[model samples]
Target: MEKYHIKLTEEEAGLLSKIDLRSYHQNHEEGRAAYLNNQEPILALLKSLSGRRAVPEVRLSYWNDPNYRSGRIKGSRKGLFERNGCTGSDIYTHPHFLEQLRYFLFGTELPDAVIEAFEAKVGNPEWVSSSDIVPIGKAARDLTRRYRLDIAAAPEEFFKLCLDMGLGLSAAESVMRSVKQVR
Candidate 1:
């Protein structure tokens, strides 16, 4: 895969900083609200992109309705999504949007595996045992230092950057996989 050396402008960085990455990844509604609420920068950034053609309206839709089970809340959001015209292409994953988002957030186009690792490990306590916390954290710190990234101030970003930059699969695997006792 070709590597993109992405750098974020001060304004873009500030805009991304306002978003809570953890909530954006872990909780759908809260994250969507944050993005929707702080969409000026996002729209401006996309507009500035030379390769971008269509600028999507930043709004909420229910493509992945966590409340779609047989209950009162079921299809509640679906109707809203239909009314909002959010049923088309997922704007969040659109190439242009992702390109800008990745640049602002990770400073590079991280692989899908790395992104998955982040969603799996960070803020999910069951993935890593208490004993493994220190080691995993230390590993993340060391990896970030090696990459010369200044995101260590934020541990969440630090870990994601490190894992993507070449922290080896061990850190993610160690945290994500449970040890199976040999019979």
Candidate 2:
């Protein structure tokens, strides 16, 4: 495998730079909303390149549903819905997406054994544990950092990484292209 030094295009760098760690705890609602809205331009750019790839479907049945948010923080609930809905993070990070991305980028899909190895390397006890991969807290920060670096390094590699990470390929490609064009 070729080791490509991924550099973020100016737009990607700008986007990554906008992410503030404080938003994770202080103004989660605002942060989520902002992230959700930002997806629009990125998605548009991806569509231009990949021509309408399948958009990840996010289940929003719990957003306004009182039954779901009863115990959850009131302000955070809606924000969660918007962010998950817009970015399709709920779906993108699923194993299926990871497999698709791996296939697209490396021309080799991750087998079950490989996945097990990866989980071991990451030291995640519950590989698919919802609690372990809480999107509201640490996951968000980690994603922000990872994405920023990926976009900054190699747009193509970052696109491939997104796919491998279960984010839709077209969407990733589009965002990368936008970053490239801006730079």
Candidate 3:
């Protein structure tokens, strides 16, 4: 229910775009590690979350998407389908990463295998077969209705909200300021 606006030039926005996002998500760990590594600002903010609980929920919005209301999730090769609460885009959270949050923030560490075990139990929801994510048009509408989102966010502001979670004043102002410079 919390919202932040992040702005990016066409270039940084490229980093935030579905293209690089797909690239970052393709291999999951290594891909994101590589992606964030290249993106120094995002990496710094990610590290800043050490020992913190209740990190912000990362939900992306396709502001320019118009086909948001059909409620039909499309598979890359196939037309539309629904599995569980998920529609498409195999966005599985890295349990090890989340476990770190629990460990740092709550002082409890879950076994590395827990995430996989949970996935195995719940069944993984694979996205449309192709790596190309055809813009999350279907779910965007639902997301819009459910969450109060800003028109858009400045990349730095988005990262701050990502780190601070709108809980209070973010402590990462310097980091955010540096990010603006990079952009």
Candidate 4:
């Protein structure tokens, strides 16, 4: 496993500071892509800040219908997943995850156990599509609180930045696991 050091410039920091929350969410898809691509710099930022880890619960499409706002946050997996709507690839343990990990993290393929983790989550019924393994909003909030920065306030670029840096975290974790295996 190889380690890459990443940093962000003052200008880029300033650029992020000026972006508003509405605009960030409005461009969520593009923002998500950019967040995925330039992950290392954001990871660098997070490490310097030393943010907290928080698990967030997101509202899944089937779980939280607007008409049924009373039952928005569901605790059970029953009736949450639409059997008809689900495809083989849409499940969590699909091969696409390993392929993405290979492309982003290393020249070599991921270990079988890593792949198994994904497979373990597949069709579990409890698995929700709305939230990520890394809770972006809460992580951003943690960074802001610890660093005394206004990350969660507006233009919430901090949150988006956290989301963007998911790939970097994944790579770092993957490398660490691989190194442990070698030892």
Best by TM-score: 1
Residue lDDT tens for model 4, 19-107: 22122434668766544544444343333322321111121211223321223554322233333343432322222232222222222
For model 3, how does the per-residue alpha-carbon lDDT over 67-163 read when each residue is reduced to its tens digit? 2112245332112222234232221222223322222222212222422332233232332222211122222222323343332322233233223
Model 4 TM-score on a 0 to 1 scale: 0.18
Stretches of candidate 4 above 4 Å error?
1-129, 151-155, 159-163, 166-183
Per-residue lDDT for 173 in model 2? 43
Descending-lDDT candidate ranking? 1, 2, 4, 3
Candidate 4 root-mean-square deviation in Å = 19.1
Which scores greater on TM-score, model 1 or model 4? 1
* Stretches > 4 Å off in candidate 3: 1-3, 18-183
Residue-wise C-alpha lDDT for candidate 1, range 32-81, written one tens digit per residue: 76656545655555444423332211111112333321234456334445
lDDT of 3 at 96: 22
Off by over 4 Å in 1: 1-5, 23-29, 51-100, 103-183
Candidate 2 lDDT over 71-176, as tens digits, reads 3455334454455563454442322233333332233222334334333433533343334333322332333344443334344433333334444334444434
Clashes of each: 0, 13, 9, 3
Q: What clash pairs does model 4 have?
A: 20-155, 21-155, 35-164
Clash total of candidate 2: 13
